[model samples]
Target: MPAPRVSVRTRIFELEMVLAGAQPPVRRRVQVPGEIDLAVLHEVVQSAMGWTNSHLHEFEIAGRRYGIPDPDWPSQDVVDETKGKLFRLVEQGDRFGYVYDFGDNWTHEITVEKITGAEPGVRYPRCVSGEGACPPEDVGGIWGYEEFQAVMADPAHPDHDERLEWARGSFDPHRFDLDETDRALQWLAWRPLAPVS
Candidate 1:
């Protein structure tokens, strides 16, 4: 008998999450398995981009909203994100939107660059490359980020010292380490969630 083909289809997704309205474009490239759920996708993004994942997030694609549906807001159109698989809902060349921190309105433009099979012995959901540092949480969005940058650049500015202190000395808006990001992602992908007793 011929060897049966294993149906494990690993997806090599070159997903780029670009912060909306960010000049020079803060972005990251990640590869995740196609069978991953939107919940896992969210975790991968958070890990890859250095986000703390401290706020609500939602994914919008093809006019459908996917997120943890709120029972309090019964009329909202969000579906449970944990139920959908990436390969079933998306494909290469498709574009989508991910909104994190609704108050700050941190919008990310997510793009699917490529889709391919998984490699043997290689871990899934890893950050391949990226550029630019993520904005601090609750920094008041793009305009605020620009103001923060200005303050950081000019020591003579009246609020320079205060802003510097606020930012914890210096802030590099262009630093990215793929290895570090992948390391952080270990908690998100490699380990299984602890089952409830």
Candidate 2:
């Protein structure tokens, strides 16, 4: 018999969370297509959060990526819903900030900011969990967040001056206006939610 075809669908949902320093609350949601395979979906999220396939599955969202598994997260269902919503929010903006699974319940919260430059000044620093560099070691590339920050902070370090200069350069905060907010909401308001089979 022929194999049964797998069905996939994408849905958007609005997510609201109370951030550390913000009053009221932070609200935003993005539409993400659902995947037939939970493993694949997990991989995509892990990649976005700077984890490679080799890393052990730990309920921690630190080390380069902001949203990993945390101890204080809500139930699994709520966490999944929050993650899906946050993904869409990040995809929509030029730059965004997220704090996931911070407190009990592993709630993932994100803030999408507006990008001003012609080019999106966003950087996805991949985590180096001892993965063999794709290219041979000869070629140099950008370092991960920890390494980069360390180098930039240490004035005595060789790359500190250059890294510091790069960090100091002026950049616009990617904040959305009322119209963009409405658009994001509309997108999520109409999205369909279904459990992954």
Query: By lDDT, who's the top model here?
Result: 1
lDDT of 1 by residue, 1-197 (tens): 43112234445677878889976568888887777789989988888888899999999989999999999997998999999888898899999999998988889999999987656555667788888888877788888888888888898999999988888988888877778888987765542223335
Instruction: Give the per-residue lDDT of model 2 (tens digit) for 1-197.
Output: 43222223232221222223322222333222322222333333333332234432322222224224445753432233234333333433333233332221222233223212111221111111111112111112222433654565577999877766665642112232434333322312222323335
Model 1 misplaced regions, further than 4 Å: 1-7, 190-197
Residue-level lDDT for 9 in candidate 2: 26
Top candidate (TM-score)? 1
Each model's RMSD to truth, in Å?
6.7, 14.8
Against the true structure, what is each candidate's TM-score?
Answer: 0.89, 0.26
Task: Report clashes for each candidate as comma-separated counts.
Answer: 1, 16
